[model samples]
Target: MDSHGSSNGLREEEIDAVAMAVIAVVVNTMADKESSSCNMLMRLRQRRALLQSVAEAPDCAATCEAVVQLCVALTSGVFPRLTPRWWIKRRTGGTWEDLRLRDDATDEYFRQKLRMSTTMFNHIVAACAAYMEKKVTHYRMPLPVEQLIAFALYRWVSGETYESGTSAFGIGRATGLQAFRDVISALLQAYPDAIKWPMGRRRAQILRAFREKGFPNCFGAIDCTHIYIDKPAGAPSENYYDRKQKFFVQAQVVVDLDLRILDVHVGYPGSVHGVRVLHNSQLFRRAESGELFDATPENLPHYVVTRGYLLGDNGYPVACPWIVSPYGGIDQGADEERFDTRQKVARGCVERAFGRLKCMWRLFLRTHKTNLETLPQQFVVVCTLHNILLDTGMDFDENLL
Candidate 1:
């Protein structure tokens, strides 16, 4: 009986050694094939079959049970089951992508889709790419800068709903909206000086252009327009209600003869008059301090001498010589009538500038449904884009007017 028991003890020792060796081999195999869960499971199953065959022999049941339990613990819960990382198969062959591949696509096509020439669009992409770039992550790659710009331009020009716009770009609505805001911020940062007031040679050119239009020493035309918005939540909504029975904020713009926006002041409530809006602008303060233009008086016909001035409508106060307004009141002499007529012609530049602005960027044509606080930044961004396009000599289609 002692010899039989000793033989069983020797058998148990051999089985314990076998279990340890198998565990080491399985661990090494799992480490080598860590990336593939399927392979690890297959190896585990093969090893379990081999162990069970060994357990079929005499006096190895208890040791085999212990080995199986250890293997089960290692395979079941010792290591986390790594789910294969994946992304939803989004539609990549969308409008912007297709436009990029089509050889026949023209500047006109780009203008129709993006409200700018292809060259201008590419220029904007180049300028804003640095600000729009994002870091890559383990889950997914960042979107291309061109895609973000195209999505923003499409949304701005088309004035479509976020759902429709996102569908066109094969992105979710929230993603598209966030992309639009990011692009706007990128533009604001990339082109900070795009809408600056002209100086030196540029100012001289603007004066010459206005002089040809029969207004001497004129810098630009200034006016105010309403940018409609939804009812405000914090501010007094009544202050935003305009004469047109719409809630809006006002934008005061100074435009050159070519309808390029030179300076802009936005965010005043629509109920405020143009004169009051002007009073609150930096332009007004600069003009008041005689720092905005050359203060030397230039002589005109009929002994009318004045410095560089902006032509405005009757809505502005004529208290300052720099801000020239049309002669008001019905009973006017022929000379005053002629002066008013010429002033109207030259000041029409501002009106046409507003028209082109709304036509090109139709986002302003509708009541703004997004955050009210962001409207001012968006306004400045659009104005900057407008100046950039003009600087590139890319004019909007006249037929669109």
Candidate 2:
């Protein structure tokens, strides 16, 4: 048990010394092949200098290893031919750079896949940067934004946390907490076209989905979801003011039978009731406007083929004549009960959409700390693409589907 050497057995500290010794011997032996004992000692010093040039930046050692290791694991599934160059793909997708990602799995097709796999990842980060540049900086920060937003749907929809999402990025825990929110905002604003509410198209898409599902005139399933924010400064009982029993903002969304989000209504105080949320929603106002339905679109019954109303929760006012539901004050078996059950069943589409939405983005899991000032923007960012991801072509078969 020598302090720096293996005697009885190598202790933890001795193990490092042994590893270094082995490395030293390997280098020396290679040099010794061309000459006798110490002829190439000078060359050995050059090798150490090369190693220093590749040293990890201060405090970034583990993070770099983690990123490289994660890349290795992901690419390995798609790339089996395992050479360093073959295992690496450009995060930018344009030109190949020397990432030095070596692998041992010697399959030719798999190795080709390794190079191919990085192309999509490069696009992911590029998309994030393009969005962020417009939304946050308006094309100011020239640095490449990580693929945080693109992979988000994969995480929440597929079930993962912020920590897991940024495992590929060099971002840390607290940074991730803020970064996720920041990225969503930039994404929504920058790529509104990518996640826009189809002013007229919603009508057609909803009609089609309703017909397929055997429900008519159904535009969408609507619901109120609350996102918690920290209680404001000097607000009395703010902490106790939420439906979920927390200080928060309540927002509503209208998603169609296909779980495609058609409209979003966010940015209300938690003190706002669900009915109030709908009443204030642009979707409800538009529905009540009757300009289109009366003219071109022709007021498709609120919930078309079901020959009733679009679906919603109990907190919504029983505009029972226009919208079908159990009379809030009436018994469960009242004339509206059967209708209410059917509406609830239809409403499940949006609920499941919300679940899948939340499942796809871990940022929704926690109550983000924000004031009323920014509440609407955050909720909008979360909802706008809540429906578009259905088309993002993300695979869920790896899960039970």
Candidate 3:
């Protein structure tokens, strides 16, 4: 019994020792947590005191003002303030000024530079001046109408880079581009009927000219030419790739014997055939409905033809009554061969017109770099200008061609 009681006493002693160790650990952990809490509180109080001192300091407002000014100065040095309308005052005196001073003495030079006679230039300027005029602004004086017209003409005819062209005109690149666009718009607006279908005396004159060329009741020559252009963004590039492995847009035109464009349809893809392009045009629609010419049939030597027809190459449909395409295949007889020769000569008008148009503008000779959507309008404007130049009896430098 004494042995068991001693064992129990020993166990009780061990339990007491264990309880003392656990209480010591708990007290230490609580003390450590309390110390950490006090330290955090003291730090927070110190930060509050610092903030209060800064707020209450006598020079704090001045300090902030100084800091703000310093920031402003730094920013000013880093990024200078931009002017509302910045421009350089360029000195005016170039080929344009020389031509203006010499006036009629420089008529040939004027025609060479702008592809128009001085009189025609003045006439165009007069017609477009009202539309081209800009209100005088405090920022700068508006460019003169004559200057604008001359710059536009020079740019269009020369196809010079904007940097060089603008430099020649003493204008900014943006200003030069805007001037060209404005001039084009003004021309289109002023001469809406510049490319209209022949009527009354004009129709009779066109018919007479073609009759002299051995094609009776022929209205015009129809053909298509590719206008090279950069592949348009967001459009299928393959659609514009042509047989020459170049990107282009097709323009179908009908021209009288004088090489005056009577009708034009532009903006078809380069890969599209001339027949397809023609079929989709208003010209085809009018011809199909017999609205393009009188339906009265005219007797040819071998055939009776109704509706004035357009002469086209063999690429166009010979099946259509409104169009006369050259005889194809090697088995053609003498009569057919002779007719083909005359037809080819008549068709040459459209080809020559295209050549002259491209040669004069020169812009169309290179791949166009402007927006594709504006191309049709630009082409129409050029064609109108071509007709106007022709009407004025402006001489083309065949040497340039």
Q: Top model by lDDT, which number?
A: 1
lDDT of 3 by residue, 7-54 (tens): 443344443454454335333322322224665566446434433433
- Runs in model 1 deviating more than 4 A are 1-93, 301-304
> Comparing candidate 1 with candidate 2, which one achieves the higher lDDT?
1
List clashing residue pairs in candidate 1: none
Candidate 2 TM-score, C-alpha based: 0.54
Q: Local distance difference test, per candidate? A: 0.79, 0.51, 0.76
Q: Model 2, residue 22: displacement in angstroms?
A: 37
Best candidate according to TM-score: 1
Cα deviation at 33, candidate 2, in Å, is 34
**Candidate 2: worst 10 consecutive residues by lDDT?**
93-102
Task: Kindly indicate the candidate among 2 and 3 with the higher TM-score.
Answer: 3
Per-residue alpha-carbon lDDT of model 2 for 1-401, expressed as tens digits?
55443323435454445446544544543431343246346545644543342232122343345335434533442112222333323233211122223345322222232211243435445656645553422212222354344334333333345555445443345655666566666767555764444446656666666656545655666777766555665555553286557777666777777677766777666787778677776666666765223212233435533332466666666653344444454556654676666667777887877666664444465554444555576556656555444565543322321
Q: Please tell me which model should have the higher TM-score, number 1 or number 2.
A: 1
* RMSD vs true structure, all candidates: 9.1, 15.6, 23.1
Q: Estimate the TM-score of every prediction.
A: 0.76, 0.54, 0.75
